[model samples]
Target chain A: MKVKAYITLKEGVLDPQGKAVEHALLSLGFQGVSGVRVGKYITFDIQVRSEAQARDQVEKMCQKLLANTTIESYQFEIIQS
Target chain B: MKFGVVIFPGSNCDRDCVHVAQTVSGNKVESLWHKETSLPRLDCLIIPGGFSYGDYLRPGAIAHFSPIMPEVKAFAERGGLVLGICNGFQILVETGLLPGALMRNVSLKFICDRVTLEIENNKLPFTCRYPAHSLVSMPIAHMEGNYFADSETLKRIEDNNQVVFRYHGDNPNGSLHSIAGVCNEKGNVLGMMPHPERVAETLLGGQDGRLLFESII
Candidate 1:
């Protein structure tokens, strides 16, 4: 099984990188862009017997390592192939 | 006093810390490897600076799981003195030993310069040598040193007098409350972004940082 995860800074947390990109975009004449936020995308393979088990495992991984609950939030999808 | 400095794979300041410890105390100073699961008996332990684990994902995120961290946590729990500087501070936060997180600088720049810091609380085992409300200059070098915490947590930390140092004149990284250093509730664990070890010697530029080492003695 393969899993894909998106990790993002929680709302109300300042995203300096995202803000910088937004400024660049506006300066480049791409207007009407708002609420820019930067995040991380990660993918990994896991060996599991069931989707439920994979979800549980990924949740633990996100909580312990992939995402710091204090500042970031994460969501993932388990892909069966 | 016996001192130990933990060396992670990418820790560049491990030797600097050892040098300070040896010079300050003239006592036994050991360099503990990150793979070791146990620690030798010591009066103080230092997690020095540098790009530990290549600062992958997040600074100190990977190194938090190093085999030595469990021992470090245990040592802190026992009220043994622990000092984490720069990257070491990030690891302490990731390990939950310290509150808050170090975010990217507001300007997103790597700041490396000597800055003035106000000693907020000189009563801890770490800052006891300094006079109350005294100011000192030390070098701070880091990209992710802006400290952030929720309102409630910040209030608790402030109410408990956990903030040990605050940027005096300039908020270099736009840290919340201008916090440059903080300690755990028990005041046994300290995490700060400045490199006091770098300025421990007179030839390094200043001797103000030596007072911190003297505080421990």
Candidate 2:
């Protein structure tokens, strides 16, 4: 199995990098963009037999390594590979 | 007093920390490799700044699982004095030795310059040489120095006075409460973004940074 973890700054957390991206887009004449937030996308291969097992393992990975619970939140999708 | 400065694979400031801790502060110092499973009895441990493990995944993420961290965590749990500067601060938070996490700077640029820091609490073992609210200049060099925590942790720290140092003038990295440094609830472990090791000698510049090492000694 494979999993994709999307890690992002939690709501109400300051996203300076995201803000800078938003400003850069505005200066470049990008229109109708209300906000811009930046996050990380990571995928990993897991040797799990079932989707439930992959999800469980990925959740632990996200909590322990992929995401920092103090400042960021994450979600993952277990794709049957 | 004796000190040990942990040296991660990519650590660049370990030598500077040695100079400050040994030559400047006149304390015995040793370099502890990151893979070491044991530590010598020492009064203080300094985790200096650098891109440990090339900051893969996130700053300090990989280093948290290094061989030495188990001992470091045990030392911290026993109230051993630990000071994490710049990249070291990132590692400390990542290892759960401290709360909060360092995020990318608000400007999305690597910052390397001297910034004024206000000593929020001089009562800490690490800051007692400086008077409360005293402003001192130190160099901060890092891209991910902005600090963030959940509302509950922020509130708890605010009430507990865990903040040890804060930016004096304009908020440099967009850290909450202009925080440049903080300590754990027990106040034994300190993590700060600024590099006091770089400014600890008069030949380099003013000796304001020496006060921190001096106080610890």
What class would a CAPRI assessor give candidate 1's docking? high
* Native interface contacts kept by each candidate, as a fraction: 0.69, 1.00
Clashes of 1: 0
For model 1, how does the per-residue alpha-carbon lDDT over A1-81 read when each residue is reduced to its tens digit? 999999999999999999999999999999899889999999999999999999999999999999988889899999998
* Candidate 2: residue B186 Cα off by (Å): 0.8
TM-score for chain B considered on its own, for each of the candidates: 0.99, 0.98
In TM-score terms, candidate 2 sits at 0.96
Candidate 2, residues A1-81: lDDT per residue as tens digits? Answer: 777889998887888778878888988999876567799999878897788888888888889999998888898887786
lDDT of each prediction vs. the true structure? 0.95, 0.90
